[model samples]
Target: MLDTDAWWRDAVIYQVYPRSFADSDGDGMGDLPGITGRLQHLQELGIDAVWLSPFYPSPQHDAGYDVADYRGVDPRFGELGDADKLIAEAHGRGIKVIVDLVPNHTSSEHAWFQAALAAGPGSPERERYIFRSSGEEPPNSWKSVFGGSAWERLPDGDWYLHLFDVSQPDLNWDNPEVRAEFLDVLRFWLDRGVDGFRVDVAHGLVKEANLTDWTTTSTILGGLDPAGPPPPMWDQEGVHEIYRSWRRVLDEYPGGRILVAEAWVAPASRLARYVRPDEMHQAFNFPYLDAPWRPAELRAVIDETLEANDAVGATTTWVLSNHDVVRHASRLGFPVGTPRMPGIGAEDPQPDAALGLRRARAATLLMLGLPGSAYLYQGEELGLPEHTTMPDEFREDPAWERSGHAERGRDGCRVPLPWEADAPSYGFGPTDASWLPQPATWAEYALDRQQGVPGSTWELYRTALSLRREHGLGHGSVVWQEDAFAFRNGDVLVLTNFGSEAVKLPPGARLLVSSEPLDGDGRVPTDVTVWATL
Candidate 1:
């Protein structure tokens, strides 16, 4: 079913947002043992691997993206021993593990950053970061990806650049020290038996050599902008060199270690470069994630993604939701053109819950049927919706402070998950403590309610994932038709009717799975996807 050279070609990778997955102790935080304990859910869900987001020591400014240390686990999550056990436990269940690697920047509290701060301007320590002298002003007119100036002035009157938050100082890739350090970081994890890494800000490790001023007017930025050329700080040519060196580290390890890029590049064609034979193994299909739910938009992205990856002999990866943005379920409910803020609040218009659930289920079937690897964000299989009503006082995302409360930030989507319908903390722990509050409404979607119920959301995931492997759907070849899409891998034929009305099935096609029951007339309804054998 999978490509022989690459184990990830058609694998299903589940993402675990550590802080929200499950809490082990009563301290109200998710930890490594909590994840290890919950391995049964993933094993039952039928994913081939699990991608754990960063659990490294941090100020939590960017939710562990700014790593204070690369070699050890943060005490809040657990010690290094807990992580080693988690990896082994997952492996025992036949699931590979991929950890997040943030190479673009490090937490300001990192020893190197502290040294840079204490050493002041023109010191070799400052050379480890991006320090420039433009006389009290920032080096350039560029903006931070979060908000405000990309540069922060130091006590010495010199400025240092941070493309992300001020607490995250960008590393100097031009410096040999930075490059060697990250290579060792990769080895450190690989030696720990991790299968690979999900490289954060993969395209941002290297900036343009000149550090020129930004020429664009669009302040709103995110993964792979739809309307603009590559920004000055992203998708630079020098990045490929860094990846090439890192790729060597992965190759050194056995068991097919890989590097999955979180690179947000455009045109699909440019993204293909990251997956060339010697670079990273795969890049997130952000273009598809950003696409509207319209049939045309979705179709174009699939075609471009497949074509580009085919050119490089690499696999394409698809994802529906993650920790950083609005959940796909809620996003699909809003009017097609509504602005998608990171977090939702009382001021925002409510989305249609019923419509959102239907579309989200349909989207899942569609994504799983596609040819190549897929990623499932934690809680999507349980049909979780974004917690749009998180109170202002509890908000902790940097975007909240950065946006001056005008934007709600991403706390809603990061809410702790519900596992038991009636238990305190919804069975996220033995007690009712969680880093982020679980909504009262989450009981309706708890895993306890969904488990073992035929035609339930949990069963749907188990069935689809099982069928995907049984029928080799992940490595299929897709064929598009009017108002519908179909694909074949081995004996499976997955078809979807994106049109507004029901449609008759192809002759002799026996149904294997459907997102919703068929109508009395046996027509495939709009916003439904089905698997069949012809």
Candidate 2:
């Protein structure tokens, strides 16, 4: 097994969505220089690394996931030289750099796709992708994650499969050439001194050879369709083989590079396989993120995740929010109105603000104190709440178009960072207009406003991360204190009370961190609390 004590184990990784992180050129979109300028901010937050969302050359159909080139940086983000600078600068600050590697599919405009299309059926290049006979229809009744049929009829009358958007055609992992080409892409970045990669949709690399029809056994999100009936190709058996091959390639690198997979599945037991020593170093655990804010549900998810992953010798990771979903602050019913609740309460509720802050702190402590790596989405440390005001005209997410108005897509959470409140674009850029407007509420939530404020969301994150590093919290065996509803890391114990009442700790326990500080003895009876051995 690869060493579980690598730098990334239990490390806090801050994600940067390039298009909205910072804009250095006043072009209204964030770029590499903007990111380079903010390295100190990350360092101050105690993050060990930064996982930049894809900045590769792409048609932007799916906002850069549909990569057209693996080696080149998108001009909007920066040039190849800028990427090298980012790596060097980040390394100098003791912060590892992990770039997004979208290997599951490539943009239809990718050179390989173009070549395959030009070569016609039966050509060697055609095998690099899933191409079927022109006369036949789609092999199965599978739907894309975005919507509609997963199969698209190409101009040549053949069907090309895409699990996501049509612009992103899934690569045929059955083809050795496809495997070799992607491995080369991995090497290309490693050669450039990248610390590691967050493999996008890593589990979807391989699909079942049979391409059988999905079995509608249960209902999916929105109640529109039933799930459980295996989609034509999700969680295919062949995926493990591909992961093993990728692991071999990663092992060859000298840095002992890390690979974190984005795998979300049920039976919890099956999820652990992605992080087996032979596969990835870590895979995201979405159980807590997806579960309702209830004590029993939360407890069960934690218990099941630990139990399921017991045999895997790799670190576990947790995230509450990312670019693709609604912010946790909103999901937990923190005064944020959804379609279900409109104009539902008093204009200003102190309890709402306090609850939101407490929950945010509790979630951070819970994630950081877990026995694995933790991921922090951009702006999450600042406790930036979601803003879903983007008009249809301004929306760039493909999910927006695909889901009609049923879903807001991810544009709200992906909006520009609020760096400076007074700046025209919240310090994202000096431009009068950004690709997406910064939320007006940024005046209060901007980074500058909360940098050192005690009890502030950002400060809580800084404190939690620093404490984890100082006490070596995530490196030891995790013993869950069932009665206290906490996870113990060595002598340090993280206690969380999802309920509103103050949870009484054992008399001898010392307060290490609390979302709400008690007036005396440095203890607060808040939603969440952490205690360490005195």
Candidate 3:
């Protein structure tokens, strides 16, 4: 009999950024009840699971990623009961729940950090975190991922490592207490009925002892060279041991509780190490996400990813956009080979909305047709474009200040979702004011506007997801075609045209779906995807 618990392997998981998902109480910020109220939307959208971003007690310094308390939800989101309810309610609809676990660092306001600050350097309390004496310079020249220096100085003539914003202090995993604490944190959520965890900075929990600086820019968090020598700060051999222990903890629970790593390692082989049968179940396919729309590049990434995961007997996960980067809709709208940046701004070349939406829809079909799991960021179903024109004054991403306002940060992609047209907050809530401003153009793509509309992006996503299950295409091998981005998933074949001209469709197969209307001659147009039953 097939095991039912391993739902994660090919699950089409939807990612929810809590503060922007929904605003139940009209506080202008999304909360737990808001997510609960909107669970039906996900159920109807045909996802297998929902991976929520961090909503733990926090200073909101990094938008809840800098968790202050691992065991409790922030009051702004709801209490512990709401979390329990969200889990139970989601499971009721046959959707599994995976919450974010930020083990890499904690908010400086955390009890341990607060106690360490009061205990000063060298004390046992201070040992819980990375602390060094100020001797005319920082411990090293490691820069913070957000910007500036990775080390922050305190009033007591000692410095602590942040890696991110100063408000987030990196925990010293070498300490036994730290490891034991995270084990307990895992149990705490597992006990709460969470099916799994999306570990934040999974490659960073353990650092090299010497704290050697690669002098690699840390402006991107563990910005180690993917093709160069392994850096001292990330993807250390020590991280695997940590996961081995975590794997054991997960096994103690039933229902196949899983852990998904957010490791940024590369070359496919190094990434395979994190999911070797005994460790994590899956890791984000950042390499695939970063690949441009070119057919050759996209095909190569898929081949490399499949080969790597095949080595470890693990599943590969494909994600296009997330909270941390520019929306793929806008990103793909740029010139075919342009780089994907942290954020888009008014000064930057604006994306061609019509052209971008076309490519995005095609990308969605292409991603879902792959032979592994897929993740959908909150508003991608509506074909939501990034709010590239957010007012500079309202920008709050740490990157803005860290880069001296030169980078513009990630606020553009994080604007609240529009649910209804001509309604307050576009029906994201009863109020018109959301934490981040919503662009007026979003109304055209609101969920209410797209529901039941034929050929809308939302309908396309729904049809694709439904077809994925009916054909069991998610759990198979691919046979790549040399001429175009074409591959077979079981009895179905997915073909995409990245070339300027039309590509002839394979004969003798039933056409199931196409991203664009078939050309007059019924060929696949540029930037289009089509599925067929072979």
Candidate 2 on 199-240: residue-level lDDT in tens?
Answer: 887657778787777744311122111245545455677888
Best of the two (1, 3) by lDDT: 3
Which candidate do you rate higher for TM-score, 1 or 3? 3
Model 2 RMSD in Å is: 3.7
Candidate 3 global lDDT = 0.89
Cα lDDT of candidate 1 equals: 0.86
What is the clash count of model 2? 4
Candidate 2 Cα deviation (angstroms), residue 191: 0.4
Q: What ranges in model 3 sit over 4 Å off? A: 1-5, 221-223
- Per residue, candidate 1 scores C-alpha lDDT tens digits across 1-534 of 223557788899999999999899968889899999999999999999999999998888888988999999999999999999999999999999999999889998999999988888889998999889999677889887667888898778988888888999999999999998988888888999999999998888888889878855323336656476667788889999999998888888888888999977887889999999899898999878878878778888999999999889888899889888789889988877566666788678878877788888889998998889999999999989888777788888887887677778788888888999999899998898888878889998999999998887888999999999888777677776443576565677777777778988888989999998888988999888888888
Off by over 4 Å in 2: 134-136, 215-229, 334-354, 519-526
By TM-score, the candidates rank as 3, 1, 2
Top-TM-score candidate index: 3
Candidate whose lDDT is highest: 3
